[model samples]
Target: MHDRPAPTPTPRSALPVQARLIVAVGIASALHVGKLPPALPLLAQELGLTLVQGGFLLSMIQFAGMTLGALLGQLADRLGPRRVMMVGLVLLAAGSALGAVAPGAAALLGTRGLEGVGFLMTVLPAPALLRRTVTEPGPLNRALGWWGAYMPIGAATGLLVTPLAYATIGWRLTWAVLAVLAALCAAGVRVYVAPDGPRARDAQAWAALRHGLHTTLSAPGPWLVASAFLMYSGQWLAVVGFLPTLYTEAGWSPARVGWASALVAGVNLTGNIAAGRLLARGVAPRSLLWTGYGAMALGAVGTFTAGAGLAYASALVFSAVGGLIPGTLFALAVRLAPGPQTVSTTVGWVQQWSSLGQFVGPPLVAALAARVGGWQWTWTVNVACCAVGALLAAALHARLAQQVRAPRPGQEGA
Candidate 1:
């Protein structure tokens, strides 16, 4: 009686604040990836970067993800996502700072590889962290939707702001400023997010990590989701990454190109948000994916083959509609994880393929452009990706239906 009941904690009340903070951290991390395109022209001039090298630069930041994503995911599982994420943010700051001082293209390229490692570490664990914090399905879906938008938002901001920053402070200072932003983001995560509890002893922890890796890799759900992401990411990055170049070549002013490219990228957020809301309202994931892919196909054709104004409009449609793929895939990754312990590993696996797509996509498109002497043929790549994605979406639908009909032991008869 004297003790009275301990004050009840309301996680629901705190959910929005925590979720927003987590998303903010993701956005800050994404700024590093987005900062490149706007600065590419300046970097090329200053560092003597060739066209192919520029494409490599665009894709180089994905190197770590392509090679180490799953392993890092396992590390995240062993270390706790919050700890991994904070460490990643610190790494990003360090990398950006170093990159700011690079003397040549080769040096800058090396720093970009370092940034790639940090990028994988920072983003791979985010979906799992969100799942752990937001337990309710509806809110979780919406939160994931926003999580998916972080890249486009950060990228769009970078596109719009970098030219202005370059005019005033130059690219080197801009890099330094981003480095500072990443550090602040890390600090914010430490103060606002709850700490991960104690760890298991070494042997048991290692065994558990091994088990999670095995389970995640062996699961069909992870593989299918990963494949779908591979199909979507390559094409998306290729289109968006080159838009600034495309506009520049068209004789638009730097400011005009920045603003226009930013708007195209920014519109993608709408589709991401819409996907989450639709999922929350009981819409079929397959339907949304199909619609997204179809629109992407149509948009790609229009973007490349049509006149300038129509092409810009088509780019908007391509990005906005294609946004549905990532939103749905994130939600699916959580739901389709073999178990709670495997969520990050599953996400890591998915991210690896996504990075592969990004790593290959830009270079492939660039080569194609060089070969054809224009971007008109770019639609073929996007269309092929869309076709493969549609087939994968169908397979995913079947897999989900099978899962529903044969629920896991704990979920049976519920």
Candidate 2:
């Protein structure tokens, strides 16, 4: 018998539509994370949560990512990105539905942990999926850029919608609505996206997974990327996560706070898109990283120390510039993966560190605020994180340069 022909690649025309569907799924998963900030004040009233507890609540959804991101990545590589993501969406729906009925803080926290796992499952495989789907270099960069923006887009949408929903239907119903959205998104993914390739035998699967994990862990690229994300994500989440609470404390109305915070989060997508364009135009990733971190530090200072008008302006600037980091990191994760088979694994490792930063940053900032009795010292934490990020960027630059200088297998001494 003749050997079977290779499967045809996704047609260029269909690529954009499928990519959009994948991004839509990601945005839906992120809604669970973003929905909480707007509802936090109400939760405090009903749940009797303290500031520190609220901080934990904000970070709780990352608990699974902090622990299981890499393992799930390997699982994605072994099973299929599409399958993994669909399962994730179902779990997200379940978690949100459960959270809607949670009677107290502890029960809500448990549901948040479930949501975390779903979020990780949905998002961790996405960059790799995009890589497989969008073949052209320029469009691939742009798609990854949009993928990078999914969180901000979803979170901003959540911020804008949640307060209105809370006013009309209340937070519980808002959660239920998002759960439905997740289910819908999963159905879209199933219908639109391509299925995974055939699975390898068990022995081959185990061997490939082992190799992917080792390759991802041993490489400096993933570690550098993960470390930079750690520095960026912690401060970014801490500041943005508390914005609703901060505004409420300052006596702003819920509607006003929702709009303002949404604007801050929305501008982040602009930077994310810009980073992809810049990279495609040959801009250095390290340069973008440094600019993002520096701007974040300056914005943090203004946000904390300046008067009201400048403080709000600083927040917008902070979020917009800081957006460059994730877009660049996503591109780097794909470019720097040790092998084609290891892309999701590498992203998983990077995500775990990013989750850890988010997990720790909020509580640390909240503790500081409680100790100092004000938000003035908030700039200190952000600035320190940015400073560390700048140093990591320099190291990453050196690594990239080394890669450029190294010879390909057959090109040695040519």
Candidate 3:
């Protein structure tokens, strides 16, 4: 008799359309974050802004995420991710529009701050929403993996398009264009994503808030995940943020610099998507993370030290392979949540650290480069971050292993 064939597992590509829509919302928010980079030179010229002020403008969007990410995450869990996200989109639209008309740096900075808060709200609860949207593990992994790429995807789109937009219509109109895009995204979310209505009262709300915060904050899982993200994010943003300057100094044109930087950011999606597929196929999350961090360490070292030709290639490999970390961490966030109710809170914690890293990383790298009179020593700082991240990944893997082998009492069979 012929041996029977095993049943085929569901394809990762089978993610639901609504889930994809949710991921698009995230991408839209990320576009807003990225739009300002290319516009910085124009802004500095128009506003007569100093270097310090310019740095603030770039990082202002992270203010809310740095200060209130966890709190917003808890809020999203209580009120509803869809509704909060809609509010976030509206804020992004308003901030972009307002910033477009600003008379000076002060006004523009304030608008950017509002955009930051909006961005925080838009992204904090996404993982939980994705978790709820995609119930099955295989498709969910793929979905979450794609979800992780939303940042680089949005950032790359903004980096590549904004400079072109500026050349055609000027910076003010470029800002207005993103405002329109944000508005459209808000409408899409309202129509497509199901809204959860307001829950009872302040009493129940307070209790839920406490529970979510405690659950996320008390767990070692969330801490490890958040810290690992911190280490990876700071270095990633620092390198990508400065690439345009580095290339321009080497005599690349404005257009070439923009496209090259965008491409480096864009290729990160390959690893993000692959991580989901590999996880769905039962690859160990720990292994993927180790590989990512290791690549980042080696890549940064080469990018700073190697000749120009190989440096770019190393950065590309660094970004592509490093994509595995976020994709895996996102999958792990859902699994390692203290319970169903706290998933968003855990993600919020991750976002909080991520914001902190982005806020600090660029400035830290800039300071180091200034001190050394060049970027030659850049790798020394970033490689340290990668090393720490790898260590944290090991700790997280051990924790996950423990949880898997010793399932909770009621969940033993499961």
> Number of the top candidate by TM-score?
1
The residue pairs that clash in candidate 2, if any, are none
Tens digits of lDDT, candidate 1, 250-318? 999998998998898888888898999899889999998999999999999999899998988999999
Query: Scored by CA lDDT, what does every candidate get?
Result: 0.87, 0.88, 0.84
Candidate 3 lDDT over 220-275, as tens digits, reads: 99999999999888788778767876786799987998899898888888889899
Winning model by lDDT = 2
lDDT of 1 at 302: 95
Cα error of candidate 2 at position 8, Å: 10
Candidate 2 stretches with Cα past 4 Å from truth are 1-15, 407-414
TM-score (all chains, Cα) for each model: 0.96, 0.95, 0.94
After superposing candidate 1 on the true structure, give the runs of residues whose Cα lies further than 4 Å from its correct spot.
1-15, 409-414
Clashing pairs in 1: none
Ranking by TM-score: 1, 2, 3
| Evaluation by TM-score, superior candidate among 1 and 2 | 1
Q: How accurate is candidate 3 locally (lDDT)?
A: 0.84
Off by over 4 Å in 3: 1-12, 50-52, 408-414
Model 2, TM vs. native: 0.95
Residue 246's lDDT within candidate 3 is 79
